[model samples]
Target: MASSLTKDSVHPGTPGTEKTFFGHPRGLATLFMTEMWERFSYYGMRALLPLYLVAPGGLHLTAGTATAIYSVYLSLVYLLTLPGGWVADRLLGPRKTVTVAGLIIMLGHLCLALPAAASFYVGLVLVAVGSGLLKANISTMVGHLYNGPKDARRDGGFTLFYIGINLGAFVAPLVIGTIGENVNWHFGFALAALGMALGLAQYLLGGRHLSEQSAVVPTPMTAQEKATTLRKGLIWLAIAVVFYGLVGFTGHFTLNWALIPLTLIGLIVPILVISRILRDKDLDGEERSKVRAYIWFFVAAAVFWMIYDQGGSTLSLFADASAKNTIFGWNFPVSWYQSVNPVMIMALAPVFAWLWLWLNRSGREPSTIVKFSSGLVLVGASFFLFLAPLSIAQDGHKAAAMWLVGIYFFQTVGELTLSPVGLSVTTKMAPKKYASQMMGVWFLAVTAGDSITALLSNPAIGGVNLDKMGFVALESVLAVLAGVAVWMYRGKVNKLMGDVR
Candidate 1:
């Protein structure tokens, strides 16, 4: 979701000419703090969600239901980004959209802080909508702060911005997680609301430092197009309402059944989008070939996220119920484990960046496909690490905390290898006419993976048992799929990529 600004598109006062913040624009600081606090609120609530749902003092839901809800929420968050981006492009630009999004997110957290069941669900819906709107547009704004796409400082500035993200994520669980687990859960939610308030305050106060172009819609919809869009939206809304009414009338309306449509959307959208791209008469053979290659990468990324994102759901449950939460003679809350991945990212990101640079300089850097395959391998192997701990610790003894630490470390490496590279490749391989659509397709990889995770994690659907042996079998099958993907597609994908490497 990165954007490149032309000279005319960028505001003069905010581009590379400004050197107030670490030789970058002062706007970086503004955006840095804004995104930092946004992430703080996000990860803060996420760390507590699965555990909260199953806690006696909380909702006391079953693990399967909790994971199903978590996966569905995550899928919607990513899926709505498509429309979110459209909103920014066609109506309210990035700045206003971000402001509105932040306020909505704060309200969501406030709703969560209320002691009512209905409020809890309303809060989740609000937070998901707000996050969808805020996520990409804010990053787009950061890109506007640069001179253009080729600006040498662009990557460095983004790296610094990335640190802001991890810094917030790393600290959130320690503060909010500790409070939520030991104190009242509502208090922790209130803290998340406070974090968003702080972020919104700074964002508004520092608005002057941002580029004015951020408020300009890149492509305002024409009157005819707007009417057409509105018509289509109403039709979809009517369809959804009818479907809901039918389910209710039939007495088959349950949470699990309600989630099925989202899962289907996640699974089907990528296929339809890719098919449309491939069949576009405007695309030449070269463009179609590149897209064909991108399909493989997309599938690989989906599989990677399926395994990696379980850290919040399946792994969180494991930490709470199975992992020994003690180190140095002090027992810690389980949510602290949530911070490990971000902390690892902060430490390892620079190293990975340097490693890629060094390898490229020596002409030893792997192709994007190879790096993606490696990520799959690394993430898949990380799951196997659990088998060692599961093998021992008989008689209800919990596994050591270090075991989870090791797993997170490996997954972090895998993430560094694949995630950023995937984004870069998506932009490179996209047809010029459909560049933004392709980015949306990339996010669908996450949505699809999360949807599948939801189905598998639900015992009634996929019957994926939650026992140690069940986990072992599940991880083994997924790991084998990773291996099979590498074995089958590496050469074909490379050839299809043309000169993209």
Candidate 2:
């Protein structure tokens, strides 16, 4: 909103004469279409996973197990970004890294299209790792496109990029979800794989347009450093093998095991990142405080995403089980409900973009912290809105479809306020040396939130009985409490940000 963010932290290259997409770099078009298709594949598969797991022809998992697996899958997708981001910065550049990851993602989706349990599990792992590799770097590359001190177009470019993300999301559920629910789930997965393939093809052909900065590792290691890194990597690989072997071999293959390790990592990674940033000998006090400020945003973002991401798990189940689906004798596939979010996002994104620009110009834009708190409040209120209609639903009667529509509307608004702003602020507040890693850390919040959403949706752990009035009420209260906490800390957090706004 402040209009001063630049691509220097990501690209650090001189502006070029290239003009291909919207009067910006030709690379923007490449990145835009690439991310668009990637998101389509990701969300298309996501819209089907939970339902597929519970379907008779599929895994036939219980609701708890289904949601749990979904949780781990989504969480790991973001969690692996920690290491993926490190790889991008220290070994492979974002370009090659994303390209390779995209290929893996395509293969992963194809694996899902196969009708085998082994393939399913393997596919999840591949996609998670591949998504981790691509997610953080792709975003950083977008930032790289407008690299300059005076680039006022940076935020607008990101806004346009964000719209592409929603565009993909908007179309996926309608197309893939409909096919998955109506045709066959595996076929649905194949469609997702095809989407990724298209994206990969485009990225390969268009690689020339990307900034040169994205093509080189930001911090190349010397031979000795590479040896040390390889040793550490092998050690970690061994550790992971042991962990996975134990988790897989044992009879205890519950989702809780998956959730526990990631939860611990989620907790620990932020502490280490913060400590690393604050302890940097290169950073002065102001920069150190800025890193500290980022931690607050990080936590608030996790809270928001945990609640918002329920749309894929708990809310998807609700759409199938509780919501009314009929419209003039046409029954909507439960998965189609997933489209409501991106549809609202597509319609309202421009309005939000305009609002932010207008507010920034008027010097009336809220600080990032307040905007985050506002998002928390709005998301919390959405859950409360669910209570009224759901609480009064007669036996055998589904809740009105408008309830979900309303819920997603509010969620989208909250998303507009917090998500784009969060990305902008993360780039702004991050120390230049740690920019890529910080982006991964920001995604870690999403990992934590998504994992938390799954954990809470587990009826055994959180006793999530959507049929009862208490569950929604409890979540509403917790969100409001989180919002209040953010509100109370707003002034302190702003001070820590040190003129970043």
Candidate 3:
């Protein structure tokens, strides 16, 4: 039987280890490069997928259908993290699981590189499953790189790591997206494969830098439990294979209908996971209270992402349809807008890092809930910026490229405020036994947000024919109101934290 998780069970980084990367642990570099390259592949592919769907000589799908697939793919990519985290926590260690996930992701990119439509569908499945495996566990490993309870450097380390992530995000669209958009789609996917391969190679070469504890599974299943788990996994694998086969062979499979099941999964999984954790007999009063606070954070994050993550779907469409592509007669790629986020992140992260340090030193740091509220307001404001001018743009006169840039700039600000904080807090609040799973729950909020974006992007779902700006305006208002409400309840939420913040 697996030992129950407790707060003390987490492995701390090697004490007195020489700081090789930015005065942080040597492992930080390993993870930093690994995540950077991973994001490059992931975001590069994302930048192309929607465009490919609507392009000639491609899937040639409608905007609604293409975005629905995009949304489902993104949702599944994060949703799978729950099981992926479970696998790492209970079966393979984070190190091994992440390695395997990297390999699968490489294969997924290769699948996309093939010219066949079937390859495209199969590739999406592989990437989504692989991403699910890698995302939560890799993040959890980052948390493991520091000593808990006394690690003042945890948030700063994640902020620095976030820069690496944005670096990849910044570069990928420029490189892979250019070739994908202008030259050939499969070729672009090929470049993404190359990126992942490089990342995997770097990870293998730099394994020694990582904390030794990451290699040890925290919870080990008993023989009986392992058998049951294996059986269930195989059955699900078989079902997935059958479903993929049906979709690949019979042209009757509809992505719109597919959303129904995904919606159910998105809705049910978090509830079950949260309930299981909260009802755990292992939790003390303080831990239970922390879990409640975490739930509130989860909701706030979902709301924020619902607005911010439009970059891939609705925002991408706007870039193509509404935004003027020419900058001083030099036409930029639609995908290039995707790079704006990473560029801003790269520019602003250090500033925010310094700001947080200053705030902490001055004893004026925003409470976690307060920061979350600020993020929500900023994301909402990004949408309103778009609505302000585009709402009045004369028909057929494309909005300026600066408008999209402005939106992404503010959205990046909101992301910096919430994303790193969300990762740091989840790690702090997680019950030791369920650490990886809790991280998965935090990502589940992203999954829910992505699902909502997908649904809203669908014309069949009343997302079409609506004045896009009006919708953005309404959503922006709602998000701002939601942020204010959370801020009002901040005291109650802080009480739930019990001095952790």
Residue-pair clashes per prediction, in order, are 0, 0, 1
Could you tell which candidate, 1 or 2, scores higher by TM-score?
2
TM-score of each: 0.88, 0.91, 0.93
Please give the distance, in angstroms, between residue 342's alpha carbon in candidate 3 and its true position after superposition: 0.1
Q: Candidate 1 — which residues are off by over 4 angstroms?
A: 1-16, 20-28, 142-158, 206-216, 245-252, 281-286, 393-395, 465-467, 470-473, 480-491
Query: Residue 460 deviation, candidate 2, in Å?
Result: 6.7
Least well predicted 10-residue stretch by lDDT in candidate 3: 1-10
lDDT of 1 by residue, 1-501 (tens): 111221232334555343355546777778888988999999999999999999999999888878888888888777766667668878787789899999999999999999888899899989989988887677667767776544545545565677678889999999999999999898999999999999899889878878777788877889999999999999999998998899889998887776777777878877887898799999999999999988888888888888888888878887887778999979999999989999998898777666766687788978777788788888887778867666655457888999989988888888887876775666567676653446567777888888988877676576452436566557656854775686477888888988777
TM-score for candidate 3: 0.93
Model 1 scores a C-alpha lDDT of: 0.79
**Which tens-of-lDDT digit does each residue in 340-448 have in candidate 3?**
9999999999888778878988899887888899999999999889785576464667788888888888899999999999999999999888888888999999888
The alpha-carbon deviation from the true structure for residue 498 of candidate 1, after best TM-score superposition, in angstroms, is: 4.6
Measured by TM-score, the strongest candidate is 3
Pairs in steric clash, model 2? none
- Give the candidates in order of lDDT, highest first: 3, 2, 1
| Best candidate (score: lDDT) | 3
Report how far off residue 452 is in candidate 3 (Å): 1.4
lDDT of each: 0.79, 0.80, 0.85
Q: How well does model 3 score by local distance difference test?
A: 0.85
The TM-score, computed over Cα atoms with residue i paired to residue i, of candidate 2 is 0.91
